[model samples]
Target: MRPDLTEPLKLLAVRVERVLEQVLPTPELEPSRLHAAMRYSVLGGGKRLRPLLCYAGAAAVGGRTEQADRAAAALEVIHAYSLIHDDLPAMDDDDLRRGKPTCHIAFDEATAILAGDALQALAFELIANDPGHSTERSRLAAIRTLALACGSQGMAGGQAFDLGAVGRQLTEFELKRMHAHKTGALIRAAVLMGAELTGQADSHQLAQLARFGSLVGLAFQIRDDILDIEGDTEIIGKRQGADIARNKPTFPSIMGLDAAKAAAEDTRQQALSALSSFGPEAELLRDLAHYAVDRPS
Candidate 1:
């Protein structure tokens, strides 16, 4: 069964696609090859869910969704860069991403690495150059949001932890810590940056969204663990059961599937509660929280 309001999420996904293509750097320069490669990797198809979450988080706080769109696009650029590097032979050695030839597969390993580096820089540049939020405070807030979420304190740190923990047992708390930093940090950043984009720093709302992001972000990984157990590679894009194959310490590996499902549901409930004041307009966010766990991919 579908866990989302398919029509609305579908529309939002398309909007994110438009934002990415429109905002990503388009250069007319002497060496267009690398630029083209960067654009290709950044623009290549994915769910674009992170940016949509950013926009939704902003809108939940009565901020302009349009303001959040740029932030969303910028966050996605960082995400795409991570994927390109993650797929390199030096890393996961993945030859498939989003069910297509991975960056290192489509281009040489060197080009893939260069494209990832360039896209990472572009993510910061786009957020820092936001014309709408053109102020030192705005620029700093935007950069700070991305930096913390993507840096050693965030996704990169999570990856470092994951690399260290392979074939080893991690406590449930340890696992959650790793995922919160690696996967949930960007998810949270998407929302926080969306709010920052509009200069709406509602302390209560930010805290609520932060809690929601944490719940759903962890739940997202839990559900991925579930899917890795049951999903197909073709539909889910990446290899199913890869986590188990690698002997990774997943929620199911520690908590059992039934308990994991219950935990995910608990997280979803908390996520919805975080937006209780938004009334009916937060239906999409609530639906997404449910979907985060229920999605097959």
Candidate 2:
């Protein structure tokens, strides 16, 4: 029987929500304010794209869905933590996220900072303690993949590069490099972690998946740039033209609007091509590549 991705995605999302709820510290627990802030930032917001990518990567290698759950949840926790810090006064300073007040706005600035820090720690804990891995080596590898992605060489470093490039012109190559670290690293990690969870995917398959993740990550960022220009705040869940207001260097800024759209399509095609060796198991990944670029938000 042909599996329908729509139903499975819905189920996957439900499962992810449940796991996240269970995995995060309860808001009513001691240090209740921090726990509440963490829950406020992480739960009930955004499309869980990273987790979905993790699941897709697992499926690509014929891995069990259950085995992917912890990694997927961990990736999302990291993402949520990043958003909290990104919205702080010292950073992007945005007041809106996923159509609601940003974490610092909803909670006190101190709590928001603490929440972000705690979530980052929790992400590592989740992956390290994930019981689905068959051996300690596999778990360690997964931890290494995530840790490297979150550190200076990955998301944090990319963020530094992006901050430096603001109000400045950058070559297309430079912009891609910035996003590859800032936005793409965690996404790439999600894919690799999924494959690693299987403990069955060979080096060749992992390499191909990494390429696919990188292209899709670029496409996703380009689409975001486009949406910043074309989408309304009501629909996109964030202020439109915020990037232009901030003078952030983006794909459309470097390539022009028409060229940026073309670039997204080109990137998506490259991502799909990388998955050619896989069969039906990779359909979710292919669909996500399309959605990442085409989505209004």
Candidate 3:
């Protein structure tokens, strides 16, 4: 049987939620509407998978959860920002997220746009100003990592591809490449940023972690595609069949459902293989690889 990570994951999620709350601006502050929109988009929902990956990455490198908290929160903030923009009328035009109104729906489009922009800024600020980083060099490196993941060659670029892919037939390779940036980039960043903050991983270990992250990222996206088809709207916290509704190409749509499921499992196994050099400390990450593919929503 798999190791039970229910308690540990919950605790780490709680830890990161506290950090997010601390860093996000208060609704009572000036610019209250923007702050409220930001908080609404980020707080009180979702699986917190990216933050969990950040914490798990730190633990894999013998770093403490406290050291990873800010980075975890930063990843989650960036994720929230992406979701906010993705749900805008110009984008996916979704009405529900986390089983409630999306940011653009709950607030005006302008406020939602500003909320996403502000949250993006806040993610970088959190990393740049984090006291948990051992050195300026490490902090800068972490910042750079996240920046690249969010930039044209990463998440944004992938989104461009995704938008362009509507009503088009794409090969499995093309689909995977698009997701590697759109979905996988940030996921990879969370794991790498966590390990980088620890300042303990050697170059070899970092490389291994990167490999592990890449595979996990792919598996995560594949599973997300599967969930979009099979998941309940309430359970997945988004409208069911949104991808299909948008005519967005997905793993299941491209490769068939069984093939996509197998692909997710295969990538999960590859991710685990990348951790072979690690000891029991990486058990959490290994479990996460399984979770990436096996989670119901």
Which predicted model would earn the best lDDT?
A: 2
TM-score of model 2 (CA atoms): 0.96
Clashes per model (N, Cα, C within 3 A): 0, 0, 0
* Weakest lDDT window of 10 consecutive positions for candidate 2: 1-10
Per-residue lDDT of model 1, residues 203-228, tens digit only:
78778778888787887888889988
Residue 203 CA displacement from its true place in model 3, Å: 1.0
Look at candidate 3 and tell me the lDDT of residue 284.
Answer: 77
**Tens-digit lDDT string for candidate 2 (1-297):** 122336667678778888899999996799999999999988997788899899989999999888889889999999999999988999999999999999999988999999999999999899888775546787788899999999999999998998889889899999999999998999999888888888889999999999999888999999999999999998888899999999999899888999999999999999999999989999888888888887867
Candidate 3: tens digits of C-alpha lDDT, residues 175-235: 9899999988998888888889888878998899888988999998998999999999888
Better of 2 and 3 by TM-score: 3
After the best TM-score superposition of candidate 3, give how far the Cα of residue 288 lies from its true spot, in angstroms: 0.8
- Per-candidate TM equals 0.93, 0.96, 0.97
Q: What is the lDDT for 226 in model 1?
A: 91
lDDT ranking, high to low: 2, 3, 1
Candidates arranged by TM-score, highest first? 3, 2, 1
